[model samples]
Target: MAKITAAEVNKLRKSTGAGMMDCKNALVEADGDFDKAVEILRKKGQKVAAKRADRESSEGAVIAKVNDSNAKGVIVSLNCETDFVAKNEKFVELANDIAELALNCNSKEELLDAELNGLKVSEKLIEQTGVIGEKIEIGDFRTLEAPFVGSYIHAGNKIATLVGLSAQVEGAETAAKDVAMQAAAMNPVALDEAGVDQETIDKEIEIAKDQLRAEGKPEEMLENIAKGKLKRFFKDNTLVNQDFIKDSKQSVAQYVKSVNKDLTIVGFERVALS
Candidate 1:
């Protein structure tokens, strides 16, 4: 058996980001073959990943990245098993890197299959799971493309938002930013009443009517009361109807109009740790 020198162990550790003992063990197992030792370490990572396949990764980092032209953006959550690993500098960097790649990817699957330093993102994640001794993976991913895009990553990286606008106006960027922050705060269900699906609208109306009927309202009055309640629901739950965070006196739609007459939200995406 070839002796595993400290120099070889340290070299493998630097190359693979594995623990010293693991690297030494791999080197010894591979009979001091550098490539074989690296492969062994990766196999160990794969085993760890498989074992933790059912583990829930609820904590990590959220990252949002926009293109140089501001016409496209991407947001993603890189998750881990613990807050300690979530706050690691390297973990955050991994999230940022994946988000940057997501700017060009149309879907989460594509982003995972994307390559990083000759290794697919999914493979890198498994490798990271092994290095960190926990389940690490991308929890969510979304992208926005429009005439203008604005993105925000809230404090602690627990939340991220991306807003798309129909027109690129002078103040459109600021309006987009305000709307993104609004999304982070309010968690709106839809952009407007029109965007609310028929199923959800019907469900809300039914729920409202049931409550009104249970309160002894007349059957004839129940429909009208439910309609009124639905309107209130729209006002409170829709993005455009919700009061602006900065100025509660006006709706988000009114605030956007004040910024630029033609600027309007085309689409938006929000991701949270939970």
Candidate 2:
């Protein structure tokens, strides 16, 4: 067997981002061939990734990034097998890098296929699983674009929100942030009642009617009671109707109006990692 020198191992480590011992072992396995050593490391990563394929990766970080003009933003969750790995500095940095890539991607698949250094993002994720000795993958990816956009990443990187405004104005940025924070707190189902899907509306109304019938309410009044409950649902579950987190006295719509009468929340996405 050929001996692997320190220079060769260092070169492999630099190229593959693997630990010193792993690089040296790969070099020895590959007989000091750099390309073969890289391939060996990748295969190792693949093996480790496959071994943990069934593992739950619910613990990770949520990251948000906006474009230079703030007209576009993305919120992403990078998940790992354990909370200890989730809080790892390198793990957090990897998630941020993927979020940065999302700013340029049109879809989650594009972001996964995008390259980081010389490896595809998906491959890097597998590589990371090998390094961290756990399962790691992209859990969620969401994006928004409008005239103006702002993103907020909450403490511990557990929740991230992105909000878009109708038009850019003096207070639009602040308003956008406020709306984003509201999103993080309220977890609204839609931007407004109009944006709520018909299926969801139907389901809510059906559930309300069922409850009313169970309560032995008169049949003739069931429709009216369901309609009223639906209205209350919109008020509680939609962004525009929900009370603002900063000042509960006003609805989010009114709070937005106070920022700038012309400003409105055009779109939003909330991502959570648990």
Task: Put down candidate 1 lDDT per residue, 72-167, tens digits, no spaces.
Answer: 999989999999998988889888988888888999899999998668999889887888889998888888899999988899999999999988
Q: Write the per-residue lDDT of candidate 2 for residues 44-82, one digit (tens) a residue.
A: 889999999999989999999999999999988999878
Off by over 4 Å in 1: 1-11
Instruction: Score candidate 2 by TM-score against the native.
Output: 0.93
How many residue pairs clash per model?
0, 0
Q: Predict model 2's lDDT versus the native.
A: 0.90
RMSD of each: 1.9, 1.8
How many clashing residue pairs, candidate 1?
0
TM-score for each predicted model, relative to the true structure:
0.93, 0.93
Candidate 2 ranges beyond 4 A from true positions: 1-11
Alpha carbon lDDT at 103, candidate 2: 93
